[model samples]
Target: MPSMKNSSFYPSYFLLVGIPGLEHEHIWISIPFCITYAFALFGNLMVMFVILVSPRLHQPMFIFLSMLAGNDGLLCTSFTPKILSVFWFNDRAISFTGCLLQMFFIHSFTSIESGFLLSMAYDRYIAIYNPLRYSSIITSRLILRLVIVFLVRAVVLVGPCLILIKRFPAFKTNIIRHSYCEHMAVVKLADADTHVNSILGLLVAFTILGVDLLLILLSYTMIFNAVFRLPSARLKTFNTCTPHICVFLSFYGMALFSFLSHRYGKKIPPSIHIIFSDIYLLVPPMLNPLIYGIKTSLIREEMGKILWKH
Candidate 1:
């Protein structure tokens, strides 16, 4: 499409190819996607609900849990429905503005979720290393401030990428080979040189994921130091950090693989890339509630009451 005088020419809609070679197998494909999406959707909602209703669970960790759930809800919903529609109903027409909105929500929520994870790690550190001052340090006011900072950072980082997309004077193709309007995928379609957009993207991603992972590691290092020095009851204390560790691994482990695979794993299959990306987005939300419910005794007890304590 030709550029309209001063503004970029965004096509009316972009066609998404959901799982390049699995078009005919979409029915079989939808099964796992549906199941994962179900858990990701309802499980997080249940986590938030249980946290909200249970007063004993009113603490910094659970507060972060609920916030992470909500952000996961945003992150997953940003594009999964559209991806499924492209598969199930062949409804692949996403408007230009809508695609940009999807991209913004997905990226921003992802960054926000990383921030929450870092906060949760800090909460764990406080709860463990300085139990005497945990309540004082991880107060509601601190949580509110942390949330504000994360939201501002996400908007400031991702908003510019979207604006840069709008500045693209033309597009080489209106068809995105993948499901969502991923930043690089969308930028690659622009007719102009988008190296600045691309470079900024890598910088932003490293700033969010890279920094968060490093700080999380540092927090856990301090946590382990504090845990081992305990005179006794070390096993139980170590167990407390298990759920968070599992959640952290599930998210960053898959995320690292997917990011690396997409960027450097050229010899790997495309299906692997697609499936891996989908799993990280969908699986973490599904697993988080279950991990916490099983590992955290307080939450487990309260959840049992909510479900079976009639």
Candidate 2:
């Protein structure tokens, strides 16, 4: 363990650059970000409201959808407010502890969201392939257990990275180039050896995200095989999966782009990286609920009822 007694080892604060090379345009950039954040909050909350109040949506699929909405809300809330503050008020100073807390919540919610997507894939698989056993296999109790498991896994995996960061002798600088406190971004600023931290972070990413993605793909493959055999229900099954597929692709596609660009796209402009990094967090939360609302008949109906009542 590194010496915590060394006064220089720990940083008191960090400066977040809202978007590198676009300082002059921050006010303009905030307009879209604000809109997206509001939409994400409203849309996800509406999804949760519909599911909670409407007993008809107590099915496994809708239950999972509610979980996704909740995760989206948390995910968006984790960093959007601070980023917006930076853009609007030019307040970029964040305490070191505050940054760590934000990093933990952001990454943990991301992992949880990925886990929820995997669970939703399984839900779709069972509903399409084994409709008879779907209810029995995917109960409220089971959903609760899965939620606990995902939350625990995220915390356990991310907690150690924080510890590792704390052990570093010092950071090269207190400036984080990105809008948020991502693990790698913060780690790269450290003056000490970061081999363990980097390797551990990569391992965690692969173990959680890589495994969830593989399982999701496998589940979908099995679902498609079963769907193809059913001539009468093939179209219905495909339609049911459209929203899930869309959300999955939107979330993972942006995530992969951001990850690859950060690690490998050295020649890419900093502005491009900054923009995509923000988009990766913003797009999924904003789009997931909208896709579900438009594509899901139950949610649309509930929304219609609410609108009429209002």
The 0-to-1 C-alpha lDDT of every candidate, in the order given, reads 0.87, 0.90
Segments of candidate 2 deviating more than 4 angstroms: 1-9
Best by lDDT: 2
Q: What are the clash counts of all predictions, listed in order?
A: 0, 0
The root-mean-square deviation over C-alpha atoms between each candidate and the true structure, in angstroms, is 3.0, 3.4
Candidate 2 residue 162 Cα shift, in angstroms, is: 0.8
Residue clash pairs of candidate 1: none
TM-score of 2: 0.95
Question: Which candidate wins on TM-score?
Answer: 2
Write down the worst ten-residue block by lDDT for model 1: 1-10
Residues 1-310 of candidate 1 have per-residue lDDT tens digits of 2222343455777777777777798778888988888888898898899999999988788899999989988788888888888878988778899999999998898899899999989998888787788888999999999999999999999999999999888987787767788888889888899989989999999999999999999999998888878656654756778898999999999889989999999998777788788887888888988898899999888888998966
Question: Could you estimate the TM-score for every candidate?
Answer: 0.95, 0.95
- Cα lDDT tens digits, model 2, 136-185, are 99898999999999999999999999989877888777888899998988
